[model samples]
Target: MKTASFPSLRVEPKLRQDTESVLYDNESLSQFIESAVRQQVELRKANTEFLARGLASRDNARQTGQYVEAVDVLEKLQNRLDQHKAKHTTK
Candidate 1:
């Protein structure tokens, strides 16, 4: 595969030293930076999706004048947690 060069990133000496200090034996600085950038991109995408879902829920509630009671929501969440715990504990 042909790889093109990415823009050069410049950081302070202390930041560079700190980053290098935590790397594994087989890891390279370029690989670490690339991984960090990829993680950040994924995190931003997830945040965007979360915001969209929240906005859609708000619009739906406004249109229908319907919303779940907090107590009901909490009960459902607790039930899910309990079910998950039971499954994991038996494994």
Candidate 2:
């Protein structure tokens, strides 16, 4: 596949130095920037999907006239969080 290139970016010297300071050994600035861009793309996509699902759930609840109580939802979430914490703490 033909590879495409991103436009050259210019930053303040201090910003460039800060980025370089955190790079893993032998990693290039281009590689680091590409990885960062890819991560942001993935995060944005996940957020979009999450919002879509939430909206769909809201619409479904409104249509069905069967909605969970906030207290019940919070209790379930808290229980799940507690279970997760307990599982990790035992490890």
Candidate 3:
């Protein structure tokens, strides 16, 4: 696949030095920056999805007036966790 290049970033010298210091063996500064950009892109996408789901749930609740109480939800979740743990545990 043909790759396109993004514009270069001009960061402070000290910040650049600190970032370069943490790279693993044989890793380049450009590689580190690219990995960081990729991670931020993934995180932002996840965050946006989370917000959209919450908004949709809110709208559905408003339209239908049906909702689970927080305490009931927490209790159900805790019970499921305990069941899962029991199944996974040895002994």
Tens-digit lDDT track for model 1 on 1-91? 9987789989999999999999989999999999999999999999999999999999999999999899999999999999999989954
Please, what are the lDDT tens digits per residue for candidate 3 over residues 1-83? 99988898899999999999999999999899899999999999999999999999999999999998999999999999999
lDDT of 1 at 32: 94
Candidate 2: which stretches are off by over 4 Å?
none
State the TM-score for model 3: 0.80
Residue 86 in candidate 2, Cα distance off native in Å: 1.7
| Candidate 1, run of 10 with poorest lDDT | 82-91
Rank ordering of all candidates by lDDT, starting from the highest: 2, 3, 1
Tens-digit per-residue lDDT, 1-91, candidate 2: 9999999999999999999999999999999999999999999999999999999999999999999999999999999999999989955
lDDT of 2: 0.98
Model 1 clash pairs?
Answer: none
What C-alpha lDDT does candidate 3 achieve relative to the native structure? 0.96
State each model's CA lDDT, in order. Answer: 0.95, 0.98, 0.96
